[model samples]
Target chain A: MKLTIPGEELMGHGNLSCQGCGGSLAMRYALKALGRDTIAVIPACCWSIIDGPFPYSCLKIPVFHTAFETAASAASGVSAAMKIKGKKTTVLAWAGDGGTFDIGIQALSGAAERGDNIIYICYDNEAYMNTGIQRSSATPYGAWTTTTPAKKFKSAPKKNMVEIMVAHKIPYTATACIAYPEDFIKKIKKAKGFQGTKYIQVLAPCPTGWRYDPAKTIELSKMAVESGIYPLYEVENGIYKISRKAKNKTVKEYIKMQGRFSHLTGEVIDEMQKNVDKEWELLIRKEEFYGHTKE
Target chain B: MKKVVTGNYAASYGAKVSRAEVVAAYPITPQTQIVEKIASFVANNEMDAEYIKVESEHSAMAACVGASAAGCRAYTATSAQGLALMHEMLHWAANARLPVVMANVNRAMGPPWTVWTDQNDSLSQRDTGWLQFYCENSQEVFDTTIQAYKICEKIGLPGMLVLDAFILSHTSEPVEIYDQDRIDKFLPKYNPRYKLEPSETHAFGGLTTPEWYYELRYKIQSAMDEGLKEIESVGKDFGKMFGRKYGLIEKYRCDDIDTLLVMSGSTASTGKEVIDRLRDNGERIGLARMRVFRPFPKQEMRKLAEDVNKIIVIDRNISFGNEGIFFSELKSALYNENTDIPVYGFIAGLGGRDITMKDIEGMIKKADGKPKDIIWWGLK
Candidate 1:
């Protein structure tokens, strides 16, 4: 089935994003899904720079570049203000992986638990791309960040942010990839249908941080989902649904494409693959059990 | 309506009457009651505002920034640790030029963990470009909160109304609640030239190169300069509308005085009583209650010290390794005036130590020695 991409674009040209920036494409698709009547509450992320410098913005909508840990709370305030003003403007909280899973987690969790009316989109680029590839909680195991060098690669697994959101019993939570614009856009539109906090963690690979060819950003995003390293799924209320089934591709095939994982020995790669498999198996079990159960 | 209420409730009523469109805050000691009162106002359908109970004080200030940027009047209340937590966002709010007013219950900063009245909390945030107003009473707290919104909105800057923790925050006083219609007339709807609206899409707080960052900051400094006038004018307007007038500083028996006592917050109120007692004993001492700290009130300080032979500052907060915060700032303000007047710096009542009338009189008597450095009064 051919996915009908929206023809009209809300994202303007001449953004400050790096070439082949998957995060930029993710934002472009997000804007298309959100339409023109939206406000973006961006935290300290690549997009904060990608949106361009002061007095200049790449999006047709208003953007509030907030502090690193305040995207959710700021977006909640924007949503509250919009409600007071009787305007139906969608407040989209856009943050990076570091802003989401680490520094911003408290505010994000508070927003979710309070059922703040905003769409919190954590564009998961793994490491802190804007700040020279520092290690973040969302950086997967066996990855080489500046803080977690090749000598001592990231030993911790990526945080399960969507699961945390689901635990808050929010209206919606999902995982999408930049390679799949249709799936990502669909999830954003679905989130717009819900009133409370809707969280979407989209896999946006960073070429600079991942030490991969800039041209392979999309391909790496696709590989991330296909290899079950980042699955495409949505959890509405308590119902879990896998939007796109993983192709069961080997993690080594996905890891070999990125230089950040090149130093990973076969043993470590196998261990990483085993962790992903265990996580995927648990997700599948959750879908089977909770998918049929009412929230 | 003449009803007795705590400083926290007065702040809630002030925010309520000023028609704050949004209130986002966290509960901290001494400041919890302010947000609690706001929550009660919202619950009872008395205030038409969105009360966002944020997780932390950082988020509280951030939400206010967002709400204000979104073309709504935003307000919040916090104390020492909470205000310290919000230090980063306080700069964010001011630099963004969002007219978000906050009520800070002046509590002492802690290492040994004490929640009591002091000016250190608010004074530490003095350089954040927020227009700081130190109130002496519950009435002033209420009036300043309203006037803060006006002054901040007019000058495109944020403002913080400060009242001493427990002394003013928890203590009940008979505050006159003005008619809502009159308040609406005084502080009209917050209609900013720019806002976070889609129709007038603009990026706020974006990454700026050195090319624009300097000018943006210069504009903030210039706004603070103009904020001095706005505070005075807005205070006058508030006075005209509701019989009680305010200014950058409130003078008590300063006329024909050879020596002036300078202080802020609750200590200023105690100083006034001391001034009256000293005058009865034929002492030529008076009190200059500093109501506004930001914009420094430099011109006021200069003029107030032009005729006085000596200036004495009793600070409820210390700057550590330096003199009292107010004393240091006041001395700097009077530096260029060529007054050569000796300003005595006395640090007292830190961590909520009681500053009785006797303590004020004693500090005043010590000023006669003309100490050149900081005097840690009542230090054990």
Candidate 2:
């Protein structure tokens, strides 16, 4: 827990990420935490293309690019093989929101239930950014994606993936954001110490998908946490603790920053704020209740 | 020891002797018993392997692909819907060049849902880059399941052994189970040149641009082309070790014959029995059992087509639009061979319907040099 970033870089500079790509930063920070003795399991996501073309890799470590929905299961298989080979190497399953929240959830659930020793990281950027910003289950309410145009923006709330992983009774589960690399890398290091299934959901803000300025990537991520939208928390073996709690900021401040949410009316913003406050209260209650066990 | 075991048990014993390191499978009709036996072996400490309990057939193939990529031997079994469910991963396993061996019991695909024998389940996966073998009986099922692993590993591809559902999977036959030491000599331990090694980093199955994508596909086709030689060489080596021999196509009394009936899977046995009586009745008829369907046995087809004037092709599965899958393949294979000997195509035994000796004779009788091009045999 030195809170010091590793000097050695695993990801090479100049790859296939867009300007201020939060997913690229997440992988950079994650590789620094996990080190060289790791194999990345990348399903069909932006990273699959972003990892560069054939015979030219972006990461220094080995990468296994599997099908769209096989990251968790393939990582489980890789982890099992590593254990059999008597090598203590990390098998990291890095996927996007579409691969994780929707298609790959079943395989992830199975691996979690079986207690497969692999670190499954979902760099959620809300929509399917790699596929031209299609609507995903991780897209927030009232956001405009290609699948959900401005006329009919997303009517559903983003999926609660941390809670879903926590329900699997996994040994480690955490939610981090790309803007906070110190906390993000620390949580990844902490997850690496465990012996069972570990899941970390990193909020990767895609400027292209969210219709935001590329320079405001870090600002929007910071606002997402400050407005009580994507809270920074970790649940270790049924013991939940909120790492960073938000200040009292209106939901309008978060929505107004993104053009995807520009079409939302004031009445819909008020309704979203109410729902956000309710979810935060539920999180606080659970954290305080589980905090008793930490004592 | 010659033990009377079902085809599913034979497949289990084959995997056991070949020392499959990982078995991840799901339960489907006709294929459930195959996994049940493998699970029992692992539970009783008889097999040293990881028996992963999967929720679906997709996960079954995914888990196998993972283990195989990690440089370990993996095995799984499935039928109709389960095979269809694993369709995407089947291509993944083959395209990744992982030598994963699978036993696919040939159950009919359906909206009516029949759990009987037909080739639709495995034949539909013909272009998946997996080498396919059609088995006639429980003994062949046991023998070929073991052979599939050795052939695939040498060629660096995936293989599936196909046997008729219920007919071969449920029916018991006296099969001589090979000993571990003997099998060990025939098939050595699998140690790949590269693996999911953490110490040495290498990219696997990652993004390939259009510049290199076609070459990767060409390499797979080359492996399959080399697979023909491996299957035959290994089959001969297997024959040298044991007494039985298997070729790409098993020709039965086709020399100096005026007519020859061609079929695959267990139906070939019925065709053989009918041909035997036809020969006794002074008729020059023969049977050609198409064992390997993936590579198409083109060289064998050319030789067989030249020997006979009329070719009767019996297909248990239909392709729905034009002709039978095997029928179409055979006609194309023999198209440029300069023989216009009418390749009579007959469809029978779909959705678990039995293909009797009478049905085999009917197919031969329909091939009497007339305009009966494609016949749907024994349909009410």
Q: Which candidate is the best by lDDT?
A: 1
- Tell me the spans in candidate 2 whose CA falls farther than 4 Å from its real position: A1-3, A293-295
What lDDT score is found at residue B128 in candidate 2? 97
lDDT of 1 by residue, B184-277 (tens): 8888999999998889889998889998899999999999989988888988888788999999988899889899898888778778888888
Q: What DockQ do the predictions score, one after another?
A: 0.88, 0.68
True contacts kept of 1: 0.88
TM-scores of all models? 0.98, 0.97
DockQ of candidate model 1:
0.88
Q: Per-residue lDDT of A42-139 in model 1, one digit per residue for the tens?
A: 99999989888877998899999999999999998999999999999999999999999999999999898899999999898898999899999898
lDDT of 2: 0.89
Report iRMS (Å) of candidate 2: 1.3
lDDT of 1: 0.90
> What lDDT score is found at residue B300 in candidate 2?
79
